[model samples]
Structure formats: structure tokens, C-alpha cells
Target chain A: MTPQTGRSAGPGVPRGDLPHRAGATGWFDTRHRHLGDWAFVVNRLSGLGLVAYLYLHLVILSQLARGPEAWGGFLAIATSPPVLLFDVLLLAGLLAHAFNGIRVTLLGLGLVASRQKALWVALMGMAVLIALAGASRILGVTS
Target chain B: MATLLQTPRPGADADPAAPARTLRVRRHRRGDSAEGWDRYTAPVGPRTTVLDALTWVRAHLDASLNLRHSCLHASCGTCGMRVNGRDVLACVTRLEDLPPGEVSVEPLRNQPLVSDLVVDIESLYESLDGVRLPLVRTSEGAPGSTPAEGVGHLTRFEDCVECGLCVSACPIVASDPEYAGPAVLGAAWRLVAEPRDRDPEPAYALVDGEQGAWRCHLAFECNEVCPTDALPAEEIARLRGILLRHRVVRWLQRHARPEEVQP
Candidate 1:
């Protein structure tokens, strides 16, 4: 073992010049090279996207104050093919965020901490299944 | 400061034409000094481990290389280090399991680096010690007396082995030094979960601070890197549950007794 004494950098001391910060972007960038880590990043990103969409949704709803013609015109543009595709993407994000949330909650409750990788795979699979079902219904493929 | 050392030896019992594989080790001269990675190539056998490669490098090439290992097996956690950016027991991490080409070895992160591949684990032990955990009996029994009936079915709580790998893998401890990492909180959880512990209240109070269970983000990195299967992330989650229940109960009690509330 290396001699413990005379080590200038002790525990709790910051090594400023080190190549990487302790838990900065390194946590998500370098260290997070596994499936579980990717799940966490995706969860956070999807959550933020959902929040942004919610604000935009509220803004769109407030267009009703401009009268029926304005509101109807906005709805007509919103339901166009491009907007519909964006909505589908939003739905995918919502499903991913919701399913991953359940997985994280179960893990926090210590229900399936050991089988987290399997749980993640199962939840992501379920998310894709639900998203596909919702997409077919929204795009008039199932009707 | 990258030095490549290659050693060639013909095998007596096995095929002699097998090319040797290189082990790349990241080394730091001092705790505060700049770091450099060195490469050492040694003949790989069926049972060669990362620890064996380090041993070979030290024996043949560099005497100044510093590392710690004992038992040459996974029993002793002294050889814990980051192999290929992941925390693992060097004694048990086989070279064959690593990706083809080079295997990188470095000291455990989030701790005081004493020298090459040697981290100061005293702080981890001190954090566990600060909890002042004791097994409190729920029944009217002496300290050394046998347990009463019906209490034997409680699940056994595995104690932290002080390997420091979990702490090294903990991002909370890496960023914030004040936060007591998984190993410490996991030990606290084991004591708090003891069925016979009359007053787990003290254990709860110990971890009630901002740097305690509340700070954990439930990343599960500690659980992923734990060599002993101690499951520190699960323990931290359990501790969070206990602390949450405690806060809710305390809030309810305070609201229930309106007369005791001072104006």
C-alpha cells in the first residue's frame, strides 16, 4: 500500500486542476455510458420537454380570447400533418417520461432495486407499446 | 509520462504463440500532482486477473508503483479500484473480461488519492462510525440474552464492508463532500431496520440533516458498483422512506395537538 501520510490532497479537498469535475457533466457525459444512466438522462429530458409543451398548450388554449374565428384558425393549423407529427413526438415523450417515472418510483420504494436493468427494459418496452397504440389511434390507422 | 514495458515469456504448459496483452494504468505521483498513464504488456493466461497484471508490472518494471492487495482474492476489499472507469475489486476483475486491447486502472474516485491506485478509506469508516449505531431491543431482555419467540424471522441486514467502492461510485459524495455517501447511510439503514431496535429515532435523527438521506438523488450508481452486493442504493432508499414517514408522523402529531401549539 502507498504511504497514507504526506498526501497533500486529502478527503473533502477539491483538486481544482484535475481533468474532470467530480460530479459535473462527467456524471452524465463520461460515467453515464450504461443503459441505466441513459435511462436517467432520457427521463430528465422527456420531463423537461413535457413541461415546455404544457406551457405552450396553455398558451394555445388562451387563443380563445381572440374570438371563434381566431381560435378555429389556430386549431386548423395545429391539426395539420406537421403539427400532428409533432404531437405524436410529444406523446412519445410523455409516455417515456411517465413509464420511467413509475420505474424510478418503484426503485425508490425498494421494490425491484436488484433487477433495475430488467425493470428498465420492461418499462421501456411498455412505453414503446403504449406509444405505438396511441400513435395508431391518433393517426387514424386503427379507426 | 507514458512508459510502455513489454515482457515476453514462452509458456511451458500452454500454447507459446499467444501474444501478450497490455495493461494501461493511470498513475499520479502525488495526491496533488498531475496524473499520467503507463502501459505494461504481460503474457495473459486463462486465470490472469488485473491484480496479477499489476503485480507483474511492479515486480518486473517499476518498483515505485504503489498499490494494495491481500488474500489475492475477493475476500479482502483492499484491492478496490477503478478498472476501465468502473469501480471493481482488482483481485477478481479478470483481464479477459475487459475489452480487447488495453485495460485502464486508476484509484477509486471521490476519495483522497494517496498514490497510484491507493485511496484513503479512513473517511468512509469515520462516516459510518459517526452514526453511533447500536442494536436496541424492543422486548424486555438483557443485552446478551436470547431473543424472544417470533422475532427470529426478521431478514438479516448485511453490513457495509468498508471497501469504499460504493463511496467512490457515489456522485453525491463526488460533488458534495458534506453528503454522507451510500456506505454510511446504508449502515444506518441496517441499524434502523433492526426489529429489536427500541429507539430507531436516534438513527433517523442522525440522517435527518441536509447532507443525509434527503440529499440522495437515488442514482443507484452505488448499487451498481458494490462488490459485496451490499446494495447501498436500496438501503439509502429505505432510509429515505423512514425519514419521510417520520416527517409525516411528526407533522400529524403537531397538527393533532392544537392546544400544545404556541401562538
Candidate 2:
């Protein structure tokens, strides 16, 4: 859609604001942002991913209602390498959301207010390490 | 996507004879439904600021170009604008200090666009009004710190210049306009921290709700962009602490025996 009077937006930028700050886009725009802002973006994106995964998980579980044959067929698809890779991605999203969520909780309760930057780095570091371990386990790279 | 320039240190602009720079400035006027960019070549020196280049373009290239400034220095905070997606004072931000390339200049976000590079900052002042932010600040009495020989106390203007930079940079303000932004929240914390005989309850009442300190998702973008180093997010957290303690005290009062409740 044409969002400006004189200028047409570039392809894939269907929702540019009227010569203003990118409103909802700021949630994903990390180019000009700081560590805390990136953390918020990561947390928001991961939260949405986890919610989607939850619904997908429930729908997959509903296959059990179709009897043993259908359940067995679905299990064949579920344990495939592609599905396992998707599980690794889901694990990473969960770790990012959960760890950053803890950091946000501390901030909201007025704890460690001054050391926020340091706190974000520490928490995100833990999230990365845990995500790496989870990914290796899901991909069967570890014995 | 607009070509954004990388931020550079101030000391890089030591040479005087710099090349002509490209300024891709945002353009709009009254009754316009949307806005667009206009590219202009500004012949500039090494020390030439974004304000200087824009003023030059206005004088020679495009007279219709509208912008606002007064102090020329950063003290007035009137020349605030976004250079390459970053909020800054146009007068103080030199073009050369930004990485060499085409620079995109836009009006500050989260404020009513007046036209071109000017934004109406009435919301900022209106938010400040809720807390009645004082101009001068009481000094901290650090050990061995002394005032001037003839002076009894040390006082100065608070760090916040009411520039609205923090508001413009805030992601919460972008989503929810009613959210009291960092500038005002920081001002509120000042009153609560040092009541100086005034009741801090009113300030507490203004920012204790969902639209206040609690709404801040801890982006801390305000702290990053504040030219004055106000540490607004930190102040908001501290304000939340005060509000929490106040609520706990009132809850205790209500639960106590009628005669035992402290006045």
C-alpha cells in the first residue's frame, strides 16, 4: 500500500508510517537500538513464537483421538530430522523468552535498577549457553 | 529503506575542508496526509553541524525548508531532531561526526509533527506539569564537598532540559501515547526523592498506575539517548520502589486496630 503522499514504499515495506518513527516495527528494529532494546525485541519475538508452538503442540496431540494407527503415523513425522531441528529452534525461543522475562521481572519490581545493562548481559549470556546445550541435545549431536 | 549513517566520535572532524554532503531530509506541510524525503547537496566544512548544513540549504537550495532553532548551542534544546534514526540536537551534532554517507534527517518521533524538522513538544511540558518539575536541584552532600567560599549551598538546574529526546526514543510511547514517558517520570522521581517540604503523594499518584512507571517495559532507550544523562528508567524504577512502600504502609494501616493505626 502507498503509505506516503509523494513516495512509494519499497517492496516488502507494506506498512511504513507517515514520515514518522516505525511504530510496531521498533519491536524488530535493532539497528539503532541499545542492548536493553534488543533484549525487549528478543523477548517479544520469542514470546510470540512460544505461543504459536503451544497451539501447534495441542493440535498435534489431538491426533491421538484418531486412534492408534493415526497416532503412530503422526509419530513417524514428529521424530524426523526436520521436526527435530524445529524443536531446537523452539527450545532457543523458550530460553530467550524465559531468561529475558526474568530480567524484566527484576526491572519491574525495582530490583537492580542501576545495574540493568550488566544484568541484561549476564542473563542473556546464560540464555545463549543454555540454548546451545538444548540445541545440541535436540539435534542428537551429543551421546 | 533509508540509508542510515553510523555514529562517529566528535574528534574526527578536525579538518576544515570537507566534501559536499548529501542530506536526505523529511518534507511535509499542513493538510498533507503523509511525508517524503528531499535530497540536497550541502557544501559544508569539517566543523559544519547538521543545523548549519540545513540552514545553508534553506538559504540557497530550498527556501520552503522549515526548521527551528534559537540558542545555536545545545542549551535551548530546540534544535532536536533525528539524524540517521537517532535523536540529537541539530546544532550540536556535526555532519562530519556522523559516518561519511548520505544522512537521513527526520523530525523527532512520538510528538506531533509541526512541519519539516519541527515537532510540537507540548506533550512533554504537559507531562512535566503533572509533577511540577522544579528548575533548580538540591545538591548531594558528599563528604568533603564544599560550596564556593561565599556561598552556603550548591544548587544547579536539573539535568533534564525537557528536550523530548527520551520520549521520542521510547518504544512504549510509540505504542501507547498515553503512557507517561521517561522525561516526566524522571521529573516525578526528583520530587519524590527530595520532597523539600512539598508532599510527594501527588507525584506518586500521577505515576503509580498502568500508564506510569509500570508501563515501562525496561527498554532503557531513554537512558541511552538522554543528552543530560537523566537515567530516566532507573529513576522510574526507584519511583516504583517508593510507590510499593507507600502501598504497603497503607495496607498495614488499614489492617491494624483502629486505635493502634498511626496517624
Candidate 3:
């Protein structure tokens, strides 16, 4: 066992069981508190998801330009079992993306303070709503 | 000739009052190939400002002077120019407030100079559009009922005015073109931080990718130069923290429910 230090193993600590500390630095200076790192990642992922959805939706809608026969054919294929599974995955990603945005908004605006539970509930609620709407669309329920 | 002395008349030019100091301003005349400073002398009063002195110059000395000033107050934000190499609003900056005879004025930096003082600000508008700075409103207001209620944190993050000062002041944009400047980030933050903006996770992910929020070195210069006091660096930091938390949550959820974890 390597000597136990006051810092947590930061994804690369080998053969050492160190007490977890929030931040650590070399002997000379302390590490800077960079809380914004996660927001940056989430923004990128969600943005990509949104962009992909926009493009995919546009491509799927192109059937209209090809006439009603093309549209009906495309719809038939989209409702297949494999496609429905893919749609569920897409819906999950979409809901996650949207909820993450809500979390950022909450903290950024100084509202809801630091209550993680409340934020989670709000995010989960949005996901449920989206999932419900997606299910209705998938099941061919009339408006 | 017998000695005869006439009493000097002290009525016209002499007075007991203290002499007023003359403010000499450096002017860059238009149509002059070499834009150099020309001294414009003005009598200073107790409430005189740099704008007042420049107004005097334009009125008395140079009729063809070129400059822009609207609502000689801080509201318009149009009077932001370089004074002694620092950005400040000319209307509010008093001449007496600064060191005497040590004043210089120049147009805003890092923008296309249109003639003398005005710059082409249309590029800023275009850049804003590039970032898609729009309120992600829900499908049209349903009759009198409000659009689908946004999450709890949406309203406060929507207060950005797109002043361009933050962008102009950002060192990142100056050095890296791919680094979407502070103005863009601020808008992104507003969306990510808004409860009404639907899914902020995607926005967060967007900023985390290459040449995005990670590119920002936490210089705090953008926050310093922001006239609106929007603490953009802090906002960026918060956004990053939220993203990390999201990852942790995902990891925990996946680990706890292996069956729920999708392939």
C-alpha cells in the first residue's frame, strides 16, 4: 500500500487509499476552484443532441416534398419495433438535455438556492412529461 | 524733458479674481492623412466634463468634427470611448475627475472604424444571431393561459442587454476566433440558467465542447469590463459545476440500477 495522503485518488491514484479532499495541489500552490467545468460539458452534449434532432427531424420531414405516398411510407417504417426503440432512446436523451438546461437556469438565476432535491424533481418531472407525450405519439392516440 | 509719469489704467484687463485654467484637448481632424492631436483650449468651470470641452471645440474651433453621443447619460451606452487608453463613457467622465493636461481620446478598439468615431456594430448583431440568442418560448400562448410553465430558474438569466462591451473587453476573442466571446457565453449562460429554456443539458454540453466554455481561462476580464455587472466568469463556473454534478448523478443512477442501464 502506498502512503495514505489527505487527497482523494483523482482517477489515476495507483496503490494508494487516500482520504478524499475537495481540491489538492502540489507542494507550492493550491488548486483553483473551477465549478463551471461540468456546465461546460453538459452544454456541449445537450447542444449536440439538439442539433442532431433538428437535422434528423428536417430530413424526416423531407418526405412531404416527395408527396403523400413517400410520407406514408416513411411513417410506416418509423413506427416499426426497432424504430420505436430508437425513439425511446432519443426521448430519454432529449429529456436529460432539457432537464440539465433547467438546472443551469435555476442556479444561474439565484432561484431554488442549492436544493438538489428540488432541482432533481423538476428535471424528472419534465422527463415524465416528455415521455408521456412521446408515448402518446408512438401509440397513434388521436388528439 | 521734466519727469512726468501717467497712472496705468487697470480697469479693462486686470481683476482681483483668480485666473481660470485653460484645458488643452488633443483633436484628430478628419480628412487629415496623419491623424494627430491638435490642441483645443477651453475655459473650465466647476461642472465641466470632457464632453462639455469637446462640445466647445466642435462649436467654436472645428465645425466638421465627427463623434457620436446620444442621451448624454449612461443609459444609451453609446458614449463608450477610450479615454487615456481606458474605456469610459464620455458624458459621465469629468475633466476635473482626471489628471490635468494628461488626457487622450480614441475610438473603441477591435471594431471596424467608420470614418472618425463611429464603428460598424452590425457585426456584433450578426454574431449574436450566430449564437441564436432567442427566448426558447413554448408553442404559442394558449389563449389567455400562460405558455407551459417553465422551470423555477428561467426569468433571472434572461436579462442580458447585448451591450457588446463584454465582447470588446474579452481577451479570449482577441486571441482566439474560435472561442465564442463573452457576449455569446453570457447568452448561453442565460439559456442554461433559465427555467423556461426547456433542456439546459444540451446547452451545457455545447459550451463544454472544444473552443467553448472550457477555452475560457477564467480571466475575469469579461466580468470586469461588463457595464451591466453580469459576473460572466462566475456564471460560467456555475454552469461547469452543474455539468459535473449531472455526470455524477448519471453514474450513480446507472450503477444503482444495472437493469435500467441501456446498451
> Which candidate has the top score in DockQ?
2
For the candidates in turn, chain A alone yields TM-scores of 0.80, 0.82, 0.57
lDDT of 3 by residue, B116-212 (tens): 4444456666755655544644443445756545432343334444545555445455445466666666667766655353566656656767866
Which residue pairs collide, candidate 2? none
Better of 1 and 3 by TM-score: 1
In model 2, the runs with Cα more than 4 Å from the true position are: A1-21, B1-18, B135-157
- Over the full model, what C-alpha lDDT does candidate 2 score relative to the true structure? 0.79
DockQ of candidate 2 is 0.31
Arranged by lDDT with the best first, the candidates are 2, 1, 3
Q: Which ten residues in a row have the lowest lDDT in candidate 3 chain B?
A: B1-10
Q: Chain A in model 2: its TM-score?
A: 0.82
For lDDT, the strongest prediction is 2
Query: lDDT per prediction?
Result: 0.74, 0.79, 0.55
TM-scores for the candidates:
0.78, 0.85, 0.47
Candidates 2 and 3: which is better by lDDT?
2
Interface RMSD of 3: 28.2
Q: Report the poorest 10 consecutive residues by lDDT, candidate 1 chain B.
A: B150-159
Candidate 2 structure quality by residue, lDDT tens digits, B1-263: 12223222123432234467889998866445567787777766868999988887776667778899888888888888999989898998998889988899999998888788888887788778778764332343345666344222112126577888888889988877888889988888788776666778888877887688888888889888888767788888777887888889889899989999977
